[model samples]
Structures are given as C-alpha cells and as structure tokens.
Target: MNAPARIADFVINSNADDLAQQITLLAGQINAATHRLLKLIAEFDTCKGWSGGGTVRTCAHWLNWQCGIALGAAREKVRVAHRLEELPLIDAAFEKGEISYSKVRAMTRVATAENEDYLLMIARHGTASHMEKLVGKFDRVQRQRTDRQHDKEQENARKLVYYQNDDGMWVIHAKLPPEAGEQVIKALEAVVAPIQEERQRELQESCSTDAHGDVSAETFSATVEHEKRESGNHFQELLEHTRADALVKITEHFLATSAGGTSLQALKGAERCQIMLHVDIDTLQRNGSTHAPNPHCREFEHQQWLSPDTARRLSCDASLVTLCRYHHRLLHQGSFSIEAVRDEGHDSPALRFISAAGATIETSFFPQFPGVSAETSPLALQRLAPDVDATTSCPYWTGEHMDYGMAVDGLLRRTQ
Candidate 1:
C-alpha cells in the first residue's frame, strides 16, 4: 500500500483522543515544513534561479505561475520569507514549531532589531489574537509619537490668514493647534446631532404613516420600499443643510456670550475661557482718565474688533453676581442670562469670580425688569441693597411721575 493509504488506515482505526493528538502534531509539522520551503524559495529568487532567470518581475508572480499558488498566498509567503531574514529569533521559533504563522505575520509588521526579542517572547506565549492586539497597540503608540513630533516641527507655521476675493467675499484660512481644531470639530458635531435626530424622527413618522388606513400586502410592501428610497435622498439633503445651520448657530452663540460664558463652555475648562480685561483705575472710577491700552485683548467672535466706546458701554453695565455652575447650566438650558454685578461703594466686595464649582460671578446684567424701556433697558441700574428705603426714587423705575412714592409702590408690587 502507498504511504498515504497506510496513514489513512491508521487514522480510521485510531481512538478519538489519539486521532485528535496526531492531527495537531501533524499540523505543526506541516507548518514548520512550509516555513522551510518558503525560505528556500526566497533564497532561489534572490539569486534569479527561476526558469526565466531574472525575467519575472517579482518572486510572488514567479511562484504563482510556477507553483500553481494563488497570488495573495504567494505574495504573503514572499513577504514573510524576507522578514524572516531580519528576525532571527522569530525564524528559529517558527522552525521549532513553537509559534504559528498567524502570530509571526503580525509581529513582522512592527518588529525591528531593537524590539524583536520582546515581540518574540510574546509570540511564544500568546495566542494569535493576542499577538495581533499587541502589534496594533505598538502601531498606535508609534503613530501618536510621530504625530506629536510633526506638530512640534510645524508649531511656528500655525496662523490664520484672510483675504478679500474678486467677488468681494472674505475668505479665512486658519491653521490652529491640534487640540483647538479638535474642539471646534466637536462643537460643530454636538450642534449637528440634535438637528440630525429631529430630521430622522420626522422622516420615520412620515414614512410609517398611511392616509388610506388598510392596504393589501403587495401595496404595503411597495409603499415601504418607495418611502425608504425617498427618506434616504431626503436624509442626504438634511445632513448638508444641518451642517450649514450648525455653523451659523455656533457663531451666534459665541458672539452673544461674554468671556465668562460661551456656548462651548461645556467642552473647555472655565479658566481657559475666562478673559480678564485691564482698565485704568481712574477710568474705572469715572475720573475721566483714558483707558489703558490692553494688548492682551484679541478679536473673538468673527474677528470683529471692540471699539473703545463699545468697551466703555459694556463695562458700565458690568456687575458681579453669584450663582452655582449647576444653576448657570439650568439657566442656559431654559434661557441665557447676561452676567451682572451689584455696584457697591469703592470697597470692591468680597466677591471674586469662582469657576471651581459651577458657582461664579457674571459681569453682565439681565434686562428683564418692568418699566424699563427697550432702548434704555440695558443701561438701567439695579439695586439689591437692603438699606435703600422704598420711599427713594428707583433709578430703574420709569413711570409718568418719577416720584419716590410711585417708585416705592412699584417696588412693593413687583416683589409681591
């Protein structure tokens, strides 16, 4: 009988456990022999020893035509064969049948002379999946290091440039730091999420609703298919429109809020967004001194510069008010509030802006009082003082008679 027939007869007669053990042993032997064969093919290809000599463009192509192997398998074999030359430990492990080809394949992608020993140890003890995961982590770490190095080299090149085009439209090109760029992207995506969700809900409801109540199965199937296609096309258009709308919302949100509060406040540390503007002490006291030049202040929110008069107008209405950050969040959830402080005599009150907890002082005032005209509402003074008698005329009171009694009556009614 032939050797194969003899082996088949033995395998057919053997017990289950023995057959299983023998099969595993034979598989390892086949794997080891395959590596040896690949190494020999690599050596022959290196010397141009094929039938066509050096005429073949690649060893993989030569193997595919001559050995009847698939192109993908031949290419893989040729790659591993070359890698084996540089990886002595892995090559030895393969020959000894201590590791599988799957493990060795993953190692070769990231293995270098410096890391070969560590990689070989992992291949010897770990499963093929474990080896793949290790290789992936190694690749990610290497890529992150490379990215940081590239960013450092390009640090000085970061800038924002603008120019007016021929059509009279302004074009802005910005090169921001990686972290800042990521934050901008995240903010835009956050804004787009709800918009996409709302559109999807509307589409789902519209697609499922049928005016004709009852329908045949065939008709129902056709309607569903048509609706699916229609919804898909509408979804694409919705995505495009949502992105544009989100950008506009982000711009408006940033401009309407001051330094202490921004729409993007959730994405950044409160301290990072806190802007401090230095003014002359005399100007702050209204002594007619010119405001100091604040070089630290830069244009924000569409790059619009704040004029001196505008800055002065904003400062005059600024006030210190205390509220918890959670309360601030609730207010923003319901409606936005302008930060304001209660002006007290020259003793800068014990209020320092706190951003640690959600509690902080806002420097702008809310314009929600009655009797304040829309034109002068923003400029009206607010008093939270306890000693101020109700009989005194309130600066905020704007009624026909400007009398103390009228002011007292309005204050009591508003409080009640």
Candidate 2:
C-alpha cells in the first residue's frame, strides 16, 4: 500500500485506547520538536540579529508579527528561549520528548545550576499545574529573600541632595524609604494645615460679606490672569506655591531651632512636628494584633483613627520611642533629659531617658517581623532558597512558521 493509504487504514482501524496512546505519543514528539525551534531562537538572539538594524524592535515583537503569536506569549517564548540556553538538563529532556513545553516553561522561570536538577525532577514526576504552583511558590521565596536584603541596605541608601540651579533657585532632592518619607510628609502637612484652614476661613468670610458679591466680572478676570502670570499655571498653581512656602518655613524653623535654642527647646519643636499616635502598651508588646478589642490607633492631635497594621508600619523605625503620657508631658515641659550611654560591646551609644525626679523611662519600640528576630542578619534569607537537586543540568519551547527577515528597502535583514 502507498503511505497515505496505510496511514488512513491505520487510523480507521484504531480503537479509543489505541488513539489515546497515539495522541500522547505525538504530543511528546511535538514537544521534542519545539526544543529545536527554541534552540534556533536562542542562537539568533545571542547574535543580536533580533535588532534587524532598528527595523525590528525586539525578538519577541518579531515573533508576534511574523508567527501570529500573541505579544505577551511571544515575549514569554523569547524569555524562555534565552533562559533554556543556560539550563541543559531541561533542554535535553525537552529535546528527548520526556517532558512537555508546559513543564519546561514552568521550570525555566526559576531554574539555575543550583536548582535545575530539583526542578527537572519535579517536572518528571508532576503535572503542569503542580510544576506551575511550585515555581510560583519558589519565586515568592526568592523575592522575600531579596526584600530582606534590601531592607538591610535601605538605611545606608537614604540621602538628601541639594544644589543651586542656573535660575538662581535652590533645588532639593531626597530619597527615603516609605516610613521615613511619611514622617517628612506628616511634618510638612502639620505645619501647612493651619495655613490651609486660615485661607479657607478668609475665603468663607469674604464670600459671606457684601463686598465679595460687589466685585465686577472684569476685576475677577484680571485677578485670575495676574495669579496665572505669577504662578505660571492654572488653579492648582497657587496650592503648589503654598506647599513650597510651607517647605521653606519648615527648613527655616529647623535651622533656627538647631542653631539658636537650648537643646530642650529644640527637642520640643521637633516633637511638635511629629504625628502623635496612641497605641496600647499590650498591643505593641504583641505583634500588632488584629483581634484586639481596639485594633485601631488614634491620632492624638488630629483625632483620626488608624488601623493596627498602619500603626505597626509607622512604628517600625529604630528611632521610635514608647513614651508614657506623663513622660511625654514632661518632655514638652523640659522636665526630662536624654543622655547617650556607651554600653559594653555596642558600637553606637544607647539613649537613656530620665525624668526630672531622677526616675528612668526606659521605654523602647522596635519593628517586629514574624519568625524573624531582631538579631537576624540579612544572610538568613540564603537559607530560604530551595535546596539544589543533583538530577539535571539543563532547560524548552513550542513554535511554528519561522521566517528570516527578507530584503526590505534594499537592505538585507535577518530577523523576522
């Protein structure tokens, strides 16, 4: 029989079980062929042929337009294709049809020389869904380790930069992590709040008076035009100027208190600028409990309430102190003192707070992370990565309709 006649006969005679086995076998063969396609893609990418001398944006975009693949999927394919070059065991398994493209895709996301073998083992033993979930969990663990390391370096990275511009104006730039940045914002807002209220009150009084209603339309229009000329923007320009003025006031107040006042008076000014938060002693001793009867924090000055989670975040800094009401009042009254004590085996001096009556107020607040102690080093994250497996050394893909770049506008191109 001819080849077509024999293939048709075989298909006509096959039972359900036989067809299932054949389908599975063909699927494996397809996966194996996909590995070869990805190998070519990786070679092309490494040669920077994807650039096509600015005609093509990226390898992924070329794949999308020429191969009819979705852009997001094409990007993933490109990423996987490049990554598989570094993972040999996965690559080999994919080439041999021992694993499907789905499995290879999941393994490639996190596989490295250290964990490739373990990942391959999972791919061989598990379904695509199982492998995908495992990969997601592994990535989360890796991210958490990175975040811990970042947290350790954050303090050193904090900086404030200032310079005079060519326009004879000063420019200021600051980089602060969320908690520290929030403190600066709160201070500026506290100083600006009274000014905002005063402006609103004046506007209200003006509107209530007969004189405000007597203003001609031409006069109102001239006032708006004058404001636009001065501020150089629309309505919000005035608010921006107000904030700029507030920032200057804060800087001046800080400098004045720093250079001219007694240390106690300076401390008072500093404390006045802070956002007053009230937290229960027991709740703070706990890990910011959500089940507490009052899981809310009250803003002492603004009469606003904050969730326990927010309170926990605000209190996470090393400089945060747990002051009793009596001590807080004494602090404002200049009836308390702070002295730096150099303890044994400590690099930095510990601050000790004392009342005028000579009693010690040894309250302190420190950030708490679950399962992590205050003494835990950033290196602790190294222990969280998955253990390396010894079974595999490699990485895979599925693609079709491959094409090389055609001569376009008299230029010989290679990536399409």
Name the best candidate (by TM-score). 2
Q: How close is candidate 1 to the true structure, as a TM-score?
A: 0.34
- Give candidate 1 regions above 4 Å deviation: 1-14, 50-55, 148-416
User: Each candidate's TM vs. the true structure?
Assistant: 0.34, 0.36
Per model, state how many residue pairs clash.
7, 8
lDDT of 1 by residue, 1-416 (tens): 99999998887778665766655555455456666777898797688665241224478877775565688888888888889999898787677555677877888887776667766765555567666776666555555668776677457667888898878776767887778788877988999999867865554555554674545556656765676687998756777778778987886666555434545543233333444343433244442324443343222223434445655665664543344565556455542333334556543423344333334534322223336544422112111122222222112222333233432333234323
In terms of lDDT, model 2 sits at 0.63
Poorest lDDT segment (10 consecutive residues) of candidate 1:
378-387
Lowest summed lDDT window (length 10), candidate 2? 407-416
lDDT over C-alpha atoms for residue 207 of model 1: 51
